[model samples]
Target: MTLKKGIVYALLIASVVACSEKNGTEHPDTATPVATVIESEKLKFTIDTLTDKLDNPWGMAFLPDGRILVTEKKGEIRIIKDGKLLDEKIENVPAVYDHGQGGLLDIALHPDYTTNGWIYLSYAKPGEGGGGTTIARTKLNGNAFIEFKELFSAQPFVDSEVHFGSRIVFDGKGHIFFSSGERGTKENAQNLGNHLGKVLRLNEDGTVPTDNPFVNKAGAKPEIWSYGHRNPQGLVYNITTGELWDVEHGPKGGDELNKVEAGKNYGWPVITYGINYDGTPITDITKKDGMEQPVWYWVPSIATCGMAQVISDIYPNWKNNFLVGALAQTHISRVEVDNGKYVKHERLLEKVGRVRMVKQGPDGYIYIATQSPGMIVKIVPAN
Candidate 1:
């Protein structure tokens, strides 16, 4: 059954409305509704509405015990348990700037979370010059935080509220990697003195690793692993291949999917496929001698946010594909990559609302977080 785009939109809207109604008043754990059935090139699947109770959800982390912790842009951490949104927000969350693009952001659990009990968060932290991206870790005690520690704060905090690139991933080697945007200053992406506009590597305890790319480089922040990025809101580390990937926003066009590498420079304003937001060219060149090119890029700017790769076998047809959240386009991009190169892509769940995050749950199902009528939806194999 070939599902037309129009039918998919209608079914998605109806399902969203129905799901909202079911969770609006009582917030009960109702059976998830089949939002829509999608027939892709390889397999058919159904999207199920898990919950519609979030507000501007930015990121999510699935717990080992089947619970999920979600971060809202307004500095709240929410929990979804037994397919229901818990009314009580997690207590003792750090204060966030919550202006423009800054706010509570991505969350991830430590690889040894089951044993160490550390949960990590990246957010826009309020400070002197203004708020900037910060990474912290804490342990949850019931619905509250305990033993909270500030891990890494992006240096020279500025007042700009937009372009706080942030995402967290573990490389399974006792090291963590996170990204920070240029904080609206394009030039900062190329500067080595500041933490902004860079992918940073740190030990689990917030210390810079000795082997980080810039560790011994004078005049550079030791945490920097790669430089020259815009607002990179997505970061994922492939454990099997040890490759790190990032998806970042471009000004007008040229949203990029990068195979991020340590010590490499990803050209941003210096060389972009995009022009300035006001229709002026930032640079006429898209290639530079020493800068790295993107593995894939979007011409019309999808406002890429969170991303995750398919490694589980639950959806064999979607194996090894990347799922990127499309904010401006309001869909999820299923990108097929072959040996570090782009092959083909498809847009899934169109018009479902602004997608903020797409993640694969511990159960091997794909989960998506969207805003407007904030909700979490799941894609499972159609029976």
Candidate 2:
């Protein structure tokens, strides 16, 4: 199904109504229902299943040697070498709280990985207070992760298992950044003293950066780089622009794509284009002072998951676009952004199952992780 631009317009109209209902400025939503698929130029490709078996794979990274490392949300790391799924899982992964939304999540490699053999992982650690997002680093040596050390953990871990916004990314510098959800508590997104619903910056060794925006501020968590985000699961740092792009799930609808910047507040419970899952209004206002706006949003959310920039010549026309995995939509949203503006979006890989992660492979093809009989596949030109 192709998504037409008209759907975006109609969604904006409904969003206005949703916002108005919150402020008592309008009665209720009776607008025309928006269509899901936006019509755009479609491409032809053949999906080759590299491996038909992965257990709820969440995130993936391509090794410099063309092998891939995939994270199964069930607290294991599976590796694919020479296009074959290795029978054994990598060892030394810590135990995870694999209930509800908590589990093993995103994984990334150091910029200088070849020299350092360092890899980072974001997982939900079970503790006294249910579970919380945690980041740790380990040495990848001969099919095993050794010398595992905790880098950072969200403070005051809550008892809920939902909204663990745990995606890890390297800033191309020595600094590492990861996101944390509010753990099912909406108001926690606005609290400066907590790590929930915030993007944090830290040195590779888990120390807060001295130049972080919240550093030296009174009563603010010094690790916080940005706040007021919901359950962000997709984070990518654009090497060309040095800008961090993030995508997060919203209640009912209003999934968001934001350009994360230091110290910025991305309105969540305060201002949103979405309402509660029970159809209750979250905020009447979508725009507020001191809150940064999303670059784009989805009404009737796609339940967005993993994301990666498309910069390879293997797909020439897709250069400068982003391949976003849509779990609910079961397609890849090809979003085109130019000069800090979202130009348009198209859907790809229709009927490929619920896409969990999308990444550009070292060989320049597009690799995807899918759920429901979990599998790892790649898209190559239909020659």
Candidate 3:
């Protein structure tokens, strides 16, 4: 999967395609394009390797000064400044669990970061029972963290290592949204008493918002924005439409892309298009009365992870589409949707190493973080 310098890829739109639908039905009309190289003057891009020095890079955040902050799964925060990866890691990062699928996971800057200088992080925090997902914030001061504060920690830390559904996004309204996996416990997704397996919303200072759906519901965690999620690793807030979207991993199959709304129940174990990893049926039903269906799902699991929407016009043909990282298949899933409805799909950068995260840089270009070789690459117009 060594990507040569200045390699170009094409974007082709076919009228007929095939894709997996929410009801476990294969849409007869939609087909996922694979290695379809049709040279186009309109939609072409080249991959430029930024740096190949990272270690298991999990998430990335761009600074106003054109620097990049990347988090490695093993608890280091590295910086990419002036087009080169700095040798120094940020100092004073909090201790993370740093075990299977745990560590410093995602990084984000405050909406008012220019004035407040606040940076937020989601990591697996080690505690009494075991390790669980945690969110914290701090201000950066010359390669060191200052005014560091723990914002929230998912309760009842379990001993499991996998399924830490942690990604962070802001709504530009003084609130933060993050995901938490069920800690390998399927039933936890359905339980509201614990923070596991839910999308949480809180104020910038870690206070539960009063208008949250379950604020008054006894026995429910007040920070919960939505419940019944499996392991949502990819989350994004559409500032234009004011919608929150998440993509979570499913077992053997059934990776889901959901339109997350307040208080909605996204069935995980109770109803799934997936089965046990060893090929046993988790359940016979894929739909139930109260549970919501995904906008789209992937059979044979792409291991969907960190995602970003194409909001910038730099890539005119990709405007408003979603670029999602596929770890298992090692490609970027370019998904197109219209008004929350699934429209089409394309597979880009096939065999591109384990694509861990895809983000739109503040400069209106697409940047991708990948593992195996452990590098960051930028996509720009081939023209």
Per-candidate total of colliding backbone pairs = 1, 8, 6
Give the clashing residue pairs of candidate 1, or none.
Answer: 165-181
Better of 1 and 2 by lDDT: 1
Query: lDDT per residue, candidate 3, 49-76, as tens digits?
Result: 6676579999998999888999999989
TM-scores, each model vs. reference? 0.94, 0.88, 0.90
lDDT of 2: 0.81
Give the RMSD in angstroms, all C-alphas superposed, for model 2: 11.5
- Which candidate has the highest TM-score of all? 1
Q: How many backbone overlaps does candidate 1 show?
A: 1
TM-score-best of 1 and 2: 1
Backbone clash pairs for candidate 3 read 17-29, 17-30, 17-31, 18-30, 18-31, 165-181
lDDT of 2 by residue, 1-383 (tens): 12222212222112111111223343211222222332336444545556655789998877788778899988999988877778778888899999887899988888898888888999999999789899999987777889999988998698897999998888887899899998988898999999999989999889988999989999999999999999998888877789998899988899998999999999988999999989989888999999999999999999888888888888787887888888887778899898889999987756566888887766788888888536677766654
Question: Residue 74 deviation, candidate 1, in Å?
Answer: 0.4
- lDDT for model 3 comes to 0.86
In model 2, the worst 10-residue window by lDDT is 11-20
- Can you tell me which runs of candidate 2 are displaced by over 4 Å? 1-42
TM-score of 1: 0.94
